[model samples]
Target: MKLLIRNLSRATTEAELQAMFESFGAVQSCNLVKDKTTNKSKGFGFVQMVKNGEAKAAMKTLNGKDVDGFKIRVKRAEDKPTEQPLQDAE
Candidate 1:
């Protein structure tokens, strides 16, 4: 399951984020969003867990939990809707 983590501290790293979720279960992938120009954390990231149960557990425990002075929000990541090309007028 893919989970979205928000409101993270700027100092938080991908390793630290993975560690947090690893306590619950195996983390398939952990990523911290960064600024393209400055290469700094955008204060948010995504974590992919191998199991849905573990993901739910992590979300339940970590959501609204304070980490590094920030109350992080965790929830299932929603897939963005794809935009369709406009049709030509007759």
Candidate 2:
């Protein structure tokens, strides 16, 4: 399951984030969003867990939990809707 983590501290590292979720279960992947120009953390990231149950557990325990002096928000990542191209009027 893919989970979105928000409100993270700028100092938080991807390894730290992975460790946090690893406590719950195996983490498939961990990523921290970064700025293209400065290459700094965007204060948010995504974590993918191997199991849904573990993901749920992590979300339940980590959501609104303070880490690195900031309360983080965790939830299942939603799939973005596909865009439709414009059509000329008849």
Candidate 3:
């Protein structure tokens, strides 16, 4: 299960986030969004849990939880559809 985490502090690191979730269950992957130019945290990230039950439990316990003065929001990441280009007929 993929979990979307938002409202994170700029100082938050991927390792810190992973450790926090590891207490609940195993984390398959952890990522923190960053700006291309600034290379700084975008205040959000995604975490992948191997098990659905464990992911759900982590979300339940972590949502609205404060970390470094920020109350983060945790939820299942929505699957984004692939973009397709329009075709023109002659």
In lDDT terms, which candidate is top? 1
lDDT of 3: 0.97
Off by over 4 Å in 2: none
Q: Which stretches of candidate 1 lie over 4 Å from their true place?
A: none
Per-candidate count of clashing residue pairs (backbone under 3 Å): 0, 0, 0
**TM-score of structure candidate 3:** 0.93
Give stretches of model 3 more than 4 Å off.
87-90
lDDT of each: 0.98, 0.98, 0.97
Highest TM-score scorer: 1
Q: Output the better candidate (1/3) by TM-score.
A: 1
Better of 2 and 3 by TM-score: 2
Give per-residue lDDT, candidate 3, residue 64: 97
Can you write out model 1's per-residue Cα lDDT over 27-85, one digit (the tens) per residue?
Answer: 99999999999999999999999999999999999999999899999999999889999
Tens-digit lDDT string for candidate 2 (1-90) = 999999999999999999999999999999999999999999999999999999999999999999978999999999888998989999
What are the per-residue Cα lDDT tens digits for candidate 3 across 1-90?
Answer: 999999999999999999989998899999999999999999999999999999999999999999999999999999999898988988
Model 2 lDDT, residue 85, Cα: 91
